[model samples]
Target chain A: MKNTILIMGHKSPDTDSICAAIAYAELKKTLGFDAKPVRLGKLNRETKYILGYFKIEEPELVTKIIEPQSEDMKQDIILVDHNEKTQTIDEADNANIIEVIDHHRIVFNTANPLYYRAEPVGSTSTIVAKIYKENGITPTKEMAGLMLSAILSDTVIFKSPTCTEEDINIAKELEKIAEVSIETYGKDMIIAGASIEGEDLADVVKTDIKLFEFGTKRLLVSQVTTAGVNKLLETKNQIIEVLEKIMKEENVDGVVLMLTDIVLEGSELLSVGKYASLIGVGFNAKVGADSVFLPGVLSRKKQIIPKLTEILI
Target chain B: MKNTILIMGHKSPDTDSICAAIAYAELKKTLGFDAKPVRLGKLNRETKYILGYFKIEEPELVTKIIEPQSEDMKQDIILVDHNEKTQTIDEADNANIIEVIDHHRIVFNTANPLYYRAEPVGSTSTIVAKIYKENGITPTKEMAGLMLSAILSDTVIFKSPTCTEEDINIAKELEKIAEVSIETYGKDMIIAGASIEGEDLADVVKTDIKLFEFGTKRLLVSQVTTAGVNKLLETKNQIIEVLEKIMKEENVDGVVLMLTDIVLEGSELLSVGKYASLIGVGFNAKVGADSVFLPGVLSRKKQIIPKLTEILI
Candidate 1:
């Protein structure tokens, strides 16, 4: 019998991370592999809405990729959406990553040769959909819907600079299969995902947090999309306190939270911790107290991370 | 105008490394990219014989992937065959690695998402050949011959344990295109590659060297194929001296030389420096002075690196 393989995404599960893991796991299962989809953390509002709308269940929550006591079993895992150690599940270093299907910058290595397929696309779902097509397996309607929602969520309805032509084309094919109007369903999903009202400031700040190492320094970058950035900024001091607390707790050198306004196609950037001033230097903007508004900064992967890496490193 | 993209393999250019780069560059050029294949070092006798057989010129030798004075140029590179920092050319850290097509264990990272396609196969030429087929482009006779020889050379005419069904199938297709009998051509290539009659001890030992870092300790592993291990063993002391000199000059923790006998399907292992005994410990074999012969050990990637990593790390 083949060993059971777990398919997982990065922590603080976003729509792309959660949905791509499920979709790829489904594809793997169809191909006769004993694969199961898993999530590293609780699904955010966006992912929950997407799964609910498509009548799909959330993946099994796994705190760690490998159980410490089960070392003899040698758990095999396939990573999706993200491939960075800082963003992956706990004890991922111990897991035997047999394959990776990602649409993110790679900071991964392996002791043995394995299957790795990464592309500079908007979403991991786009790549998964292409894989399904390559394998001559059409995704079920529910699966197609989940993957389409993930693409729309990650690409911000094709507004993100990270969105590629392949993503748009794959989304169109998926939309046809799911029998949904792309514009209507995409807008509804985006608007549903953008609602963060009545949520705790700490939860909002930590929802999509990712840690990045620049030279010897570590920086934590968090992002949350909202229709109303100005409304969220009303509690700026509380957010700063939460960010600072997270920095100290995580022992990171700096913390940055991007309160992105999807409609405005920009972000209200907030900074805290030791290297906060470097953000201003990186983006060539003024950091007033703790916040700055940057126009046309939609993607953390394409826009923010590259700029931060350049200045910080 | 499109920017010139350099397609390169790892240093100490082997048959698979050299041929895969040329084949991939040819594929990219056909797809309308300005790509050029380059080598990091002089070709080995096996590689030289393969290129001569195919009537293909050697790739331009490049000392560095990116020149220090041309930092603004941002040289775009597509790595083939290997993807480790220690094995890559100098200044590769500065080059914009846009794509990678390799068949080795990955220890690569990039700040931006790029096209990375890796598989666990015997040779990179097998993957490149598949790409050619995927694009609906049949390789020319010379290209087919080159790729076929590469697969034969790396797989030791399908004798290495690393050889896969895909490699065999791809070689069959390439053999027909190249109009060469697989068994005849493959044996000829392997036999031609095995002759190290009058080569210097230093040249023989350093011909196919690879550097690996295990937790802070760096180890240099080199391999040379021959049909006659006894012939090479006559000068074992001189080879040990050369390995010792390499350890000191390169500041490595250890140096290992595997005199692989393709016909016998085994390697006569030699070691020097601080972690030399660990090699014997890794293989569960007794070390006598500086040599140990392990039966049925062929692929370094499959047999050697993993064992070394397990014990060393």
Candidate 2:
């Protein structure tokens, strides 16, 4: 276990993060490296369902980056999905980070050379799939299903603006390999995760929060996909309470919790922080006591974050 | 042409740099982007012979990074082989750098997002070749030969420490695609580049010099693989003059010219600038006149730079 290369993504691991970590570890293992996939957070319902469907065991949960000893310092790290120190484990800064496969803006630089594959696509799994093809490793049908499901989750079934032609092309190839229909499977996978019934309001808000940094300013934006925004709005006050606590604990300039409705193709934003009103400024809409309507804004990466950065930064 | 993406590698480009750019541009073009390969430097004997052997046209040379107009700012730039500001063209800092595929330490950071694919391997062409496979595009016979030659040249025919199993494996696969014997082709390609007859002394020294930085200290290390060290050592005085001139002009802390003998598997070091005696400190060798012999040292990336960096920095 100690000798095995631990492959993982960022905290609050989403479908794309977990699938990519596993897929990449499978690739490294195919190349004769002793590798295993781990997750920073517990699997959500959507990921749990997908893994169960494929009959693959859930990855081990790693809440902390283990403190490195002298011999352990030589251990290799391969980070996927996110690259920020805030998003990754604390001990990540000390380990020998050999490679980073992510889909976010790079805020990390190292003095020594390392392998980094960062593509501005919908999902990290898409890039990992490409890597599998590159090394001439045809993924198993089960692996193909997981990768295809991940692409659908991250891109919101091609409804989100982050969906590129490359993503669609790769997903189409994966669909044929996995023997899944795009319209039926993509919609089914996305809707499975959107069910927030058996969860706490705080847990729902905290599931996919990503910390974004621009210059000296820092912000945390939490997003959750649901079938209906109105279902989440019932507990809007409780969601704001958790978001504010997280903002204070994380010491971010602002906090935004977006309840994105997959069917409506929009989001309801709730927030409280130092510059929370700047969101209203950027979107050209007035914020109510708790939330604001964001029409046709589904992706945190493509729509929300860039729009906020353009205004706030 | 205006919409065509200008793909290029670093200044003083090598076989890997030129071939990777051409190959990556081919991959992107196959994916339906208007991409064209460009070179930052004139071809040396090695690259010229390889391209001529494959019957491929030389890429258009770009001495400077051209400034883009208002609307042209959207023109995407994809850099290969290097990402350092010192190594890249001046206009690159201002251009819309969309993707960077390199094999060196990354010092480049951007405000906005971009695609970056970096691997710690022998040649950038290996990464480009993998991209070819990922996109399901079979490389042309000419392209395969170019990529295969680059791996051999950069890895010094797998004798250098930078040659990984992945590089060797890729080269073997490329050998089949190129219809060439690895043993014969690799040796012949290397020997073809070692001819320095009638070449200017400065041009020989300047051809493969790479700038390295540790903290604030900047140094240039120029290396050339030859059949025998005696040829370069005979003109040591004339070489020192050029090294000194380059040190002053480039504003670097120091300079070392390595004449690496392919057959003997060692390098003859010529030094001029601050901390000149530290080479002797690191290698425990006597420096007489302008040169010192490093026995059993075959690579600048592995053998020379890291050893000197440990002592000097």
Candidate 3:
């Protein structure tokens, strides 16, 4: 059997991570590689909905990559969306990462030189789409839809500050290819994602958590979206209790959750520990009894993370 | 008076940083931006030597960027080579950043969206050269020489793993433009940089010091090259004593200095504190009396920093 090369994103797989992996895997297969898309964690509602809508096969869920039995180590890994080892799988340290198509900060390095294409774009799927265009290999209709959905999802319909002109331009072209009205489809997709139901409060809060470290301050920011903002805010006490537990468990300086309302177009910030004033200054949100409400804030990548980094770091 | 946009690299500016600022400022001028190159710190021997060789004027030294008086705030700052606020000038945090062309990890963000182009390459000079090419601006013979020297210095004559094929290819093109042989000029440059004279023990060690923080475990690494290894080692004890003092003052966990031999192509590691075992694991150098010698180590960016990050982070 030919050794299968795994194309994967970081843990806590987001829409960009899952779609970038699937789309890049398709691109690599077109370029004659035995590549397969894989996810590090279980697919969230948004990702599952995307895969279901596109009729694309869901990628196999994997916790770690198996070490190569033979010497052709270069065919083992192709990391997407992230380059940090802390965010990646356990076996990523040993794997020969042949290519990294990411949008985040660069931290990982390789012994042998590899194809590393990292940009400060909003979505990794934006990079994957560029790779497809550069190679002159037209993506399949399913691939196009998946990639386009990833772009729209990550950029929050181009409202994110992380969205570049290239991202908007590419997304425009992709919208045509995917045959979806961006304005209408984008709202539906976001609303679909925000309609959270049937999950425990703790699981819902931890749905899309990501770790960011700026010097000694290790912060874990978890985000959840809902159409009905007040419904999620009703269970604030339970959320904060679990958040405190998670903060201690992860040995982090702080743990916070962004209860975003896609319909209302803002977020309620729930956080613990010494970072509230820092958050108050950073987010410009009015502090209330136990939480703060952020208006016109859409992106954690551009708004929340950058603000936190500036003040804390 | 027309407002001047300042283009500069990080403090303790290396050959790449200084030359990148010069090259990028030139590129921006060709595109008709009222830009002037500036240096945050005094130029090192290698940088001074390169500017002298090319007959290009050294940039005006600037310790801080002044606040904008009126409306045109975007023209205040244009950062190159580095994006971290810790590495940049004091006023950069408050200034309106118009653009950034860097090759390091992304850390800084602005209130308004701006032009940011960051690539994972060996040197920021390489990025500047490519920017010139992209804009269809032909560099002068002197500019080519300065940029070529920057690349060679940053990559240590293409022996660094950070050097991509694009760097080697661009350097080849630059050599023809500059009318100099790469092999001879590269060695001459390295040898000249290694000939450290008329500096005290503490200054010698602190000349190229950079602070790196992996969470709370802050580290200060100082690298100095010399032709004669024994010349640097003679004052190792005094260096260690000062390094310990500096570490405590800076509140860093460890301090290490790499006494690299340019001709011999190796480094004798002198360290103070608990990170020695981490370094021992990192470098595989046998810890001798207050120092360990490692053979065939040319580039600290590739060999030293990555290993230390792995062990510490």
- Identify the leading candidate in terms of DockQ: 1
Clash count per candidate: 0, 0, 0
Better of 1 and 2 by lDDT: 1
Candidate 3, position A159, lDDT: 71
Candidate 1, residues A110-224: lDDT per residue as tens digits? 8789989999999999989988986779999999999999998888888899899999999999999998988888877877887877777788788778898989989999988
B66-173 per-residue lDDT for model 2 (tens digits): 666674565577899998887887667556788999888878767666799898988898888877876678898888998998988888888888888989998998
| lDDT, candidates in the order shown | 0.87, 0.83, 0.80
Q: What's the C-alpha lDDT at position A306 in model 1?
A: 83
Residues A255-288 of candidate 2 have per-residue lDDT tens digits of: 8888888888899877688677777666766644
Q: Give the Cα error of residue A307 in candidate 1, in Å.
A: 7.3
- Candidate 3, residue B45: Cα displacement in angstroms equals 3.3
Q: Kindly give the stretch of ten consecutive residues in candidate 2 chain B with the minimal lDDT sum.
A: B281-290
Provide the lDDT at A182 for model 2.
Answer: 82
Indicate the docking level reached by candidate 1. Answer: medium
Q: Each candidate's TM vs. the true structure?
A: 0.82, 0.85, 0.59
Worst 10 residues of 3 chain A by lDDT: A106-115
Which has the better TM-score: candidate 1, or candidate 2?
Answer: 2
Error of 2 at A313 (Å): 8.1
